[model samples]
Target: MKVEGVLVLDKPKDLSSTEAVEKIKRLLRVRKAGHGGTLDPFATGVLPICLGRATKIAQFILEGDKVYQGTFELGIITDTYDLTGEVVERRPVPELSAEEIQEVMQGFVGEIEQVPPPYSAAKYRGQPLYRWARKGVKVEKEPKRVEVLEFRVLAVELPRVEFEVYCSKGTYVRSLVHEVGLRLGCGATLVALRRLRKGPFTLEEALTLEEVERLQAEGRLEEKILSVEEALSFIPAITVSREMARRIRQGRPFSVSVLGSLVRLQKVARRPRVPWLRILSEDGDLVAVTYYPERFSGEGWAEMLRVFVS
Candidate 1:
């Protein structure tokens, strides 16, 4: 059987996220495959690879928050923030109390301005920043607002410190490390990093590329393929009658009165209460994802972001 769904790959270090997806494509012999989030070549951990129809939901996965555990070495700053780049500067480690470090970390919490690293994939004037960096060109970049939900120093060992961060999408941990080092009055560079979680997926549930290959060779690859519905379990669900499902498939809006209870309950639940809804056919097959805005007028309707038929 053809396999389709998200595969949480425990990306190995030294392999770019793209390379890992390529390996999965080659292993599964699937022409369509994409990763939800990008991991630097030197960074490793939970990289979600979507195969076949699962690629349609990759954007939603990418929009979710990510958690990472990494170690940053102080007294040295690198061009790439991580060890992949050469050290461009070095400074003496300033004497700082643990309490001081914690206080500085607190400042990073909530919404804050973050500047993307120069040697990054961020674009400038329709060109990748890395492209300019490789050509010995420096471009001034504007700082973007990124939320840092959690920033805790897990351990401190003189020049090397381990930290765990839970941040919004697009928050660069490499730039974070560099900024934190500057806050401590000492330069720093990311020495090692591993993503522990992304949205609903965690490292504990991830399978390595080697294990996936083993499964494929044994003709058990389907066992690892989660259904698209299972992958989108985080979204709220709304089961539609067969007639309503047909109407949806025909691109017609259904009566909102049927979901009256859901709307009322969601009003009390307030914002960020899974605004998206999973519309399922009477037979329990997923049809599409619908978005109902706040104070949703009965005239407003939910559009299908993804449609799945089993």
Candidate 2:
């Protein structure tokens, strides 16, 4: 009864990501568990909880893009950039056309720099900035670069705007909405947010906590778990002989020349920064994850990233 796979949880509001993971672990009686990404306690939806061996791939999943749908209240500013924080200011909402709002959102549809909110988990001087803020200390952090693939305004109702966004990892939706209000001349604060997708996991594939409990009690919890191989299916795989697999599991680096006909050596004009490959055994068991470069020749060696124990 080894539990090793991913469970997509439709996280409920008011529960921290770590709390959600703890709850899943308790319900499933799993010894090893981790989460792919962190969602604010107030935000709900697609939170991937990795069980057993699946925890090894949680970092890769965390790097994937995310999509969120949320609402922002215009003419209201909060210290935390969301409704969870205290109101800092309030102004009259100016009349604006939907087209004008769309134009402003479109301006953020690319790589942009953003400063994280003061009341956030971002650390300053080895302590969370929120801690300093709560002590009446102000901490101004340097801006960070994040990509925003899409920012669409779903609807506009005077002071409230409903929108959806597709963005790179670490792109704060609350900050994005606050910046939009800044550009519009009236401040705004996030009212509500729901994650639609994170990496390959989606809200449609997620289960509620109660459903998880019911399924576990019925011995059907495994039905919802995504296998480790399935979770990393996006990466290219190379099947090797048992000897090669054994060597990989032992963390022995094998030369590219040994792969020979099994690997199609190619040269690329540009190499990916950190391309990954799944090293599988003859029986299709994932033996290891390795750094396989595209520009490698017969002399290049595959760098082992993680060696599977079982």
Candidate 3:
């Protein structure tokens, strides 16, 4: 049987996210697999691996919020915003209280503009900024707006401050830490980092690579796979009639209004702010994913994003 679903891997440190996915693919013997998001080589924790058809929904999973715990070493600055980069500068560590640091963290909560590190995967003119930086070229990326739902200083020990933050997608925690250091006037850089959660998946439920290898050896690797429907549980489900399901699976689009004309939509009390939805067949299989940008056009059709069945 083909392995198809999601695997939450507890990525170990010093391994890039892509490397982790490659390890999983080789271990599971699956041809198609991809990670939902990227984690820096120095960072480790919840890395969602989508296999087979689950890969199609990886983008939606990546769109979900992320939680990270990281440490900042004050009095130091680096080009990469982490310890691995060259120390660009050094400053004297100033006296700072836990309350003072907490106060500073509170200022970052909510939507704010952030500038990604120069030595980062941020794209500039169709190439990663890091590529340009390697050849003695510097590409300045513009500050982007990101939502910071929570930011708290877990601990403050002299020049070392540990923090935890829950932020929206595309919000670079390293940059947030860098900004906090600048605000303290002592300058800082990320010394350590770990991802605690990504969307509906968490570190607690993630299996380490060793455990996964053991499962494979025990012939129970498939047991670890989470079904496509479970991977999309965060998205609101919309059940349609056989006819609508057939249309969706056949690459035809239909809006909630049009679906109502064919057959009543399973009533969902609350509307989802995100336009993406889980399109389920009458028999209850996830047939496709849809985007309801219906409001943008007079036709108002739920654009068929990906069809699970041909």
TM-score of each: 0.92, 0.91, 0.92
- lDDT of all the models against the reference? 0.82, 0.86, 0.84
Per-residue lDDT tens digits for candidate 3, residues 124-186, read 999988899998997778899999999998998989999899999899888888898889899
Per-residue lDDT tens digits of candidate 2, residues 81-144? 9999999899888898889999999999999998888888789999988899999999989999
Q: Could you tell me how far off, in angstroms, the CA of residue 112 lies in candidate 3 after the best superposition?
A: 1.6
| Backbone clashes, candidate 2 | 0
lDDT of 3 at 141: 84
Superposition error at 205 for model 2 (Å): 0.7
Report the C-alpha lDDT of model 1 over 1-310, residue by residue, as the tens digit: 5778999999998998888999999888899999989888888899988999999999788888899999988899889888889989999987766677778877899999888899888899999898999999998899999999889988888788888999988999999988888888888899999999987788987899888989888998787777788888887676667887787777776555555555565443333624667777768888887665565556644556666554
lDDT of 2 at 27: 82
Per-candidate clashes, comma-separated: 0, 0, 0
